[model samples]
Target chain A: MNILAMFKPNRDAKHYPGFGAVGVLFFTFLYLPILVIIAYSFNSNRIVSVWQGFSWQWYASALQNEGLLNSLRVSLTVALFATLVATVIAVSAALVLERGQNVKHAKLSQGVVNLPLMLPEIVFAVAILILFSQLGIQSGMLKLILAHSAFCIPFAFLPIRARLQGMDNNLEQAAQDLYATPLVTFRRITLPLIAPGIFAGSMLSFVISMDDFITSNIVSGGGATTLPVYIFSLVKQGVSPELNAISTLIMVASLLIATPCWLIAKRSR
Target chain B: MKKLSWNFWGLLPAYLVMSLLMVLPLLIIFYVSFMTSDAYGGYKAIFSLQSYSQIFYTADWDDNLVLNFQYLKIIARTLFLSGATAVICLLVSFPVAYYISRQSNNMKTFLLYLVTLPFWVSMVVRVYACVLILSNDGVLESGLRFFGLIGDIDSLLYNNAAMMVGMVYTYIPLMILPIYASIEKLDTRLIEAASDLYSCRMNTLRSIILPLCKPGIVAGFILVLVPCLGTVLEPMLLGGGKTMMLGNLIQNQFGVARNWSFGASLTVLLLCIVLLFLMFQAHRTSKLRELS
Candidate 1:
């Protein structure tokens, strides 16, 4: 404002054709590859490298790959189960942690909850591998659920904790004074208020579980493979159009979940 | 008032579950790292100083452990790249965020959603897109050649630079969200007040706006740095498999090497470094809050 007030208005926006060109280029560079991946999914040629006209055969073939489809199903199933389990633990932990009076211990509890996230994915993967092996627990769907659920709790807790921090205790106290049971008061007051944070946390946990390769790769035995591991293995073999097709599917799935949340967050703000 | 005791008991299930699932397993990892290797190096009950000693005593661990320095170099490089990413995101997103924040209801929401559109997509898929474009016959490589900007086909898929590109792409949303939050919190009148004082755009930005936004900047830095430290997979896939980054090494120990103890130490070391970074970040954020 001060600079504009002291001088004549300068509409330099038109003067430099290439002034913001760098940013435009940056956006294009960042986005163009993603656009190409979507575009080339229709490539009639088997080569991911060259465009030899367009067709949807790859998608049809990708869908027909039972092994790939099975893993995708497994990933989604595990992610869904993990999210629900994590949500319950996290919301409860967040409530108790927040409602409690001991600030020091609450912080410690927060630290412990976030511990799984801070540890390298490798360490957790190894720890679980050894722990499970020693227990003689066979690797299967159950093992993945157990392993993923361990990490998901913290993801569930962190956002809800943030929401919990901002909450006033008075509302709950008022409910208590009015003779409502603790359970009823919680449902009527705390849950509704913290619903958004729970939603955010669930979304985060689902994404983390769905995209997880390291822990799932390590802990789960040969029987189960997630989408990421499948994609990684196929990529190592070289980028088959099948892999490209799967990538497109994953891209679409993630985008589908993310777009709505983005809109909700933006609109709320 | 109802006693707080019963309510406090509600915390036990989560607390016990996390401690057993998380903390105890860590303890076991540290313990197993000390267990002696069997006759075939497969199974043993005997404790050996071998694993710990080998990391420093001889080439057995020296080769892999020394790789830490190389990976540390990569870690430093990754952090630098993330820092550059953070700075780039901050600069580019700030004005746009400011303008959006200043806009009327629906347009602002619609445009902000536009900014977040790509984030909705799986980051892995987007990263794979980068691979597709950078590969030998990928679009960008041929695009560059087609434009006559290069004489030969260039393959840019696997390298630290490409790794940085992936890291930046993954984290830009992180950087943006905080800056947007900070920008959103600023009162409209502050700009008007600065204008009343005849403050120039550059001066107001330097003295007033930037200072107020320091907390957000610090928060964004922590968010980026924490992930950058563990980003071995991105460099592995995107940088080409030749890059032996720390996360990859830690991953390999459990995967191929089967060395649990050494991996645990390396993980603990990384954990400590992140904790230190976060401590500094928290201090900066609190101080900035006090200043503004």
Candidate 2:
């Protein structure tokens, strides 16, 4: 009887009741708060807890708030510049690390490049703050860009490296064999193939730069507040439906931008 | 050698940026940790050991240096919270990851996408969502009231339990992804063979699955634990600024207290601990890779 039970082709064993229950419960836990924020954004009542009726007043208010608008503009500017710089640097670094087999201290170089991802953001923020002050560099948008790009290098490097690793070098070798110059082979063959990875890496860096708070908070000077630092200060004052509206809009914007990049990467894989 | 030179040229921009921005800044932090705080919210150029010694000693009423344990208590509390958050995330995420791995390919892709989608949202916004759900007359409380659970129950926000819930919620994905990667690569044939030999479900899991998943578990544990130690947003928002963790302490020193030297020392101490933990994790992971 025990053998029969054990060998009964336990294909349905994967659907064990306990596993299903936990999966359902955990997914609910993961998503409920986000749904609540989205729902509360449209609440007509001023009170966050109660849902009186649906309205779009908070969204209107958020749209018209000058401070919020300015912060959003600053965030967009920073993210764009940081993403551009970080992607270029990351691609170059990744190519060197992956393709340069004879390069000395490659492992150490790679570790140093990726160290920002491992270091605590608070510590990194404080370190940069001290360095900037000591070097007599004033904090502003330029400072924010330099810091964000430095931290974003690793995020952009990982995907690009993976893409390069998986790429068949035969195409580049074939191109070279056909008397194609190194630059031509790179521009024609390598660049086209790694385009998807570059897109994904840029998207990731952009999003990370947009979402940064601790680093931005510590380093930002007057008139250079990013959206997150602005939102944090507002939240410290009190929770309002306008904040909820802003949060929902940010979440939606992220999804719209990120979903396509993610899908492209998925399809490429 | 020519090819190597070309590669080095390619790497020059990134190397220069990292050395100037990341490495130099960290070195400055290490240097400042041994300096004295100036009255103007900056540090003196002269080196001293006062910051290091201040971690354990404080001046009493008679101006005598005495042993103090307030900072030590905060360190202990931070560790306890981080450890608990890691364990809870492990328990909650393992089953979820296992289930996801067992799904069809299409379902797995969709589910993994869903898991990662939340991570793009700002963490402050996520913590605020938790606050909305746990505060007085909030979603959870109101729902419980509707169900007639109790009368005049205390608000759930601004407490240690609330902080834990926030931490676990925020970091659960980090725990799940690593474990799911391992489970996805798992050999189901081993499970079938074990079952064919009359190994019970519990025995199969205990002897086969657990042993194989150790690397992922350790990786996930370290990933979650290390970040939890340095988190400031969750505790500050969820705990209502009533409780102080090491992250908050460091922030306070820099912000309100304006003791850059002390904050630098605290940051240095935290960095040392985190570096050691990461090195250990890397060693274990490399050892596991070798065995495999």
Candidate 3:
């Protein structure tokens, strides 16, 4: 049977009017903005909307821009370190919470862990600014690293926890029954099983750390600036083909990183 | 204390970081909000209520406070924008989500993936795209002119309508995903059963689908509304900083105004609104559990 035949046919399935049209429109609404930037990035005209001819000069200029490159370096450094720290912390916490045994205050701990996901980004930004200045922590790079990792822990922790919960307990138990120690069992059995989760979690945190604008903008404080902060300042100066080129490049990079994690998550489910 | 497992100690690093960074900082904001701002753009440690009081009343040259509606107006605009965005997202996403839920399995997966794809892109980049499209002689204006929708029009940027469009575009996915999750779990048999009982499409949707998907709708509403309230990019890029939302208002105090105490107070107020919504959601969840 075909996919449609896989489910029982319903008479009312086609009754909803305008839904199909709306779905098509929704996809267009989602993607058209990105397409506009990508298209204009290739335009040779200085005017962003008018297309004279296709050229790569915009990309060439963007690549050579020293300030943009510095910000990109800072963003990459922050994302890399933040992802590593967040994933390790997340995996450790997930192991304790999802170990198939009742842990004390698990609910409360989980709530606290997820609180960052709920609170407004502005609140975290201003609060972290206050925290750092009051504590006299003047390193902008250090502030970005700590603040990014703190919020990113929840993003990393969630997937790892979900993976742990979905794991089969029998494999670990069998290893233990075969005279494996807890450490051996974890290394030989549990760790391998949750590796995909760890990978997914790390990618997610990396994206979040990189995507953060407000927090980084607030806390970077005259020391270092990330790509988003840099982009915001450039945007305030007004739009240019160079801005379009840089934005398109960032969009492409984000997609390239996120798609693999998405495929893994889809497959695991 | 009971003997804790060795494995439990693994949680220490995360807990310590969270406590120091997330929890402590928020508490500091609360404390700093009650302090007085010194002339140097920093706070004095003296306890004062000037920050909180400034929200409703401003001290005039004569030192007598007049009732201030400026910040209150910003708060009202923020609420209206966020509320309108949530409702529009609901109306727009519900049908799309329902359509996806009714698709074949492979089709469903692909469509859902498409919906989530935009979220991976940087938010600043996405908002910048709005600038490219809506500015003078931008794609939107050019497209309109091509279709002869108008004789001449200036840039459509820097307006509340543009801001709303940008917000709905950004957040519609959040609404779609949760609503799809709930709708996917819904038994298709019920819809068939309703039809078998001669219920019309409108009644079946109203009486059956709507009630069943209420949880998803609520979840989507909170997800959309909260971010919209704290949004800074859309207002900055699309609203052209002419319109001030709560997020921009808070950022201003920290940026140009240098009143850290007042900024902290505004943040505290935003935090209270967020907490109230979360508490309401928790109460709803417990009630849902009891019902089920």
Candidate 4:
């Protein structure tokens, strides 16, 4: 039966039309919702469902909204701090894991660095919440920054580690042979080579921290609420055109942050 | 080897952060899971096995345990939904990924970028957009009405079907990327050779393409399945809180229910299941890599 089926003429043969149609449909499914959100952001109607006419009222309101602006400030501060801390830690850890002489512990450290990527975000949030409560630590912006940086480590580490692995060590060796100090060799030879990866990693981590919700929701206090948490609370209330406007702005910010990193990654590849 | 190297000391900052924030919290959750719940919404310090037992059997008023499957049902439902989402994503993404892979270099990059573009948008907003599209008088309903398929605006939100649509939509890119990566690396000569030998497309795909793409299929399946298992936002928004998945249950325990110990136990159970699945996937992929 298997042999007969194999030898049978393929009805679904290498037909480009069918495959192309599926591709078109898949892309449509992917983008239609996003496009709808962007389009609705301009709707003059207070209700998102009704399209009265094109208007910039929502955008203007979102821009002037104090709460939204405050959350955006909180989110930006957290993302920047987390990205900075995570990138530094990631670079140091990647250096040890990739370029160090200690081979046995490298695998252990590598696993630890990547562990958060595999764990569910909820578990991470819940665990951190539990730990903080048990330790009498308060949930606030500081705690949120700490948690975000922890979560962002894996994202930052991955690209930096990959760059370190691909790097040629001969230049550093040659620098050392030229009587340059280890710090000097690192400054002149190693840092410049891995700068792009570090930059990309930082950008990626920044965007992730900015976009994160679950951990922020669990860890952020009343005054420390981030944009996603605010959006989530608004969503719980009901759908509004204001959400559409704010989401569009967020989407623009993320694209601006992510596109350069994506281009850098593509070029590096 | 036990002694720290000079370079190893450089890893101290990361190690400290992970230990404090990641590893310590995980350990604390494990500890809390074994403790008893307090009257108020917190856990008592005393060790007890009550939370784990409550997952399967509940104590009756007569001091006898009765078989309870409410939590079990939620877990099973979660598993079923995750499995279905993985399967649907696999089916839809495979052909799309293949199509993208077969495109020209510039076209391939553009298509891949389009697939990943949605990911840059906030997931909460994307899910909300889905709500708008699937709501009564929403795009799907209006489109159906326009075609005379339905006489009235039908609400599709807050149903399993809507939840499934949202899950598949969110995760299809995850499924596509890995499969595309594998398929893109496939040698074109192999397909040409199979056709030259009078082999049908079925045989070529079956014997050549599928086997080569097994690793990717496995990766994509794991990627989609594991996250879907723990999805809370999608189910909450799309299922309208009518359906209780494991994620929602866990979230409830931590939030409204205030049963931290029980929530911790549920999280532990989920972690174990996810870890087991990941280990199995790792073993299978390693073996597959060796075979190929």
Error of 3 at A149 (Å): 0.7
Which residue pairs collide in model 2, if any? Answer: none
**Residue B158 lDDT, candidate 4, scale 0-100:** 84
Q: What TM-score, over all chains together, does every model reach?
A: 0.83, 0.96, 0.96, 0.94
C-alpha displacement of B289 in model 3, angstroms?
0.5
DockQ of 1: 0.38
Which residue pairs of candidate 3 clash? none
Model 1 residue runs over 4 Å out of place are A1-30, A98-104, A117-123, A158-178, A187-200, A262-269, B32-104, B115-120, B151-153, B187-200, B286-292
lDDT for B227 in candidate 4 is 85
DockQ of each: 0.38, 0.68, 0.67, 0.53
Residue B101, candidate 1: Cα error in Å is: 4.1
Better of 1 and 4 by lDDT: 4
Among the numbered candidates, top lDDT falls to: 3
Which candidate, 1 or 2, would have the higher DockQ against the true structure?
2
lDDT of each: 0.71, 0.88, 0.89, 0.86
**iRMSD, per candidate, in listed order:** 4.0, 1.2, 1.5, 2.0
Worst 10 residues of 2 chain B by lDDT: B150-159
Q: Is candidate 1 or candidate 2 better by TM-score?
A: 2
Q: Model 3: DockQ against the native?
A: 0.67
